[model samples]
Target: MKIFNLFIFLFFVTTLSNAQEAKQDFYKRSFIAYEGCEDSKDLERCYEISFHEFLAKHINRKALKDSIFFEAKKDTITVSASILYDENGKVVKRHSRISNPASNRIEGLEYLLDSIPTVKPVLDKKNNGVALSTRKLFGFYLNKAKDTIVPIFGYTPSEVPYEIIEKVPVYKGCDESMSNEDLKNCMNDKVVQLISENFRTNLAIKHNLKPGIQRIYVMFKIDKKGRVKDIVARGPHPEIEKEAIRVIKKIPRLKKPGYQRGKPVIVPFSIPIVFAVSD
Candidate 1:
């Protein structure tokens, strides 16, 4: 009995380790696939990147809603949703279960689930497309006044797999007529040019900063209205960080917002800027 139990434990451990490794490999492969294809001028590659980006942004954003809490009188509610995707990657079926159900609240949850964008089928080891399913949980709580619903927590069973956008957000004056991949490259080139033009390179010399390649990380969100917001930057020096933020804030409104399933959605973007300086 001891020997058998030991074998079972070892098997479980091995299986768990293998699963973890496989998950990591999948992410690595996904990153490589995106990076490899992102710059290609091919339409198919551009479309693939755009499709994945839309899926990632749309599904994650629409999966939770606080409005449902406002419609319900209940102090708390929990909902579970299952989304079924067809081989073609469209949502063919959806079902939801509400605990402590109220008619209005249930209706709201149902509507939200139905609005989820059509899923894209993931490829199997054989490179064959297969249907997929995912489950999500949403919790809502009533505010102190009990007059409005507030979303307390939203959870999805699996991380939504999304690739970095094949096309970066388009800036004003950048040619939009180019292919998606070319458009992204153009946007990047323009941003770099703007940074080079606007960045206070003299600040480094004044501060006696060492000569090296300085990297700044910036994060921002493009809202459904096509406006940039929540710009944040961090870098090796305060001057660099400040200048990065200032330049990013000056970005003009996008001609169009990112869309998923034909609906506009908020897309968060992050980029790293490297500046080379010489003594």
Candidate 2:
């Protein structure tokens, strides 16, 4: 009996060790692949895959789901959290911003976040492990008939390279209640509309400008306070460049500032405006 029991214990220990090593290998390969990605879109995609893999390996999803289903009484609740990681990928801090008025639900989410295991740090383009902030949204919907809760999760990088913010700065008049993806679309449409309505195409005609598509590139930053500034424009004609800058400067204060680790941060954006003129 003693020999059999010893054999069982040895098997269990070996199995656990192998599992840990496999997980570490997975993380290392994911980060290496992400670092090697060349295109911006490919890099973004790799970052997302690596992030979700990290969450899958480190988070106690089943426990978290149970806690939300059993503890939250609200029919629908949205919980947003900013998770800060150190150079070693250890969670340094976590802050939850719950839109629901229920204190119990908020507390439940806080507890779950606190219980998360240390994650493996992701490598940036520099090949260095740097501190980073990531955001997660947890949505819970209660089904009365089924006596269950349906949970949804969304993840985004809160801090990224200045040129690749996951959520761009939203314009003042855009719908604030929309999801992050929808808000981006709305902002793009609104900016194009503003430029089309205000731009002096008649100037091109008056100047006897060549009939073609004139492209203008503009880069600007929305400051931490939701104000637009640092407008720069380049175009084929000086007048076109001036008009682009003027229209961009006319943008009002944004509805909400960009965020990194629960704090507002300056967000930079670049867009190209193309004008078509026919003689």
Candidate 1 wrong stretches, greater than 4 Å: 1-169, 175-178
Q: For candidate 2, what is the lDDT?
A: 0.52
* lDDT (10s digit) by residue, model 1, range 36-78: 4544545234434443343333332223334543444556654
lDDT agreement with native, every candidate: 0.47, 0.52
Worst lDDT 10-window in candidate 2: 4-13
TM-score of 1: 0.43
lDDT of 2 by residue, 1-279 (tens): 011000000000000011111344433222222333434444434544544444333334543455544456656643444555566756664322222222324543444455445655555445566554554344455565555445533422322223224344567787776655556666776766776667666666665556666667887877878888899989777886787789888778988877654566676666777666654
What TM-score does each of the candidates earn?
A: 0.43, 0.44
lDDT of 2 at 20: 18
In model 2, the number of clashes is: 0
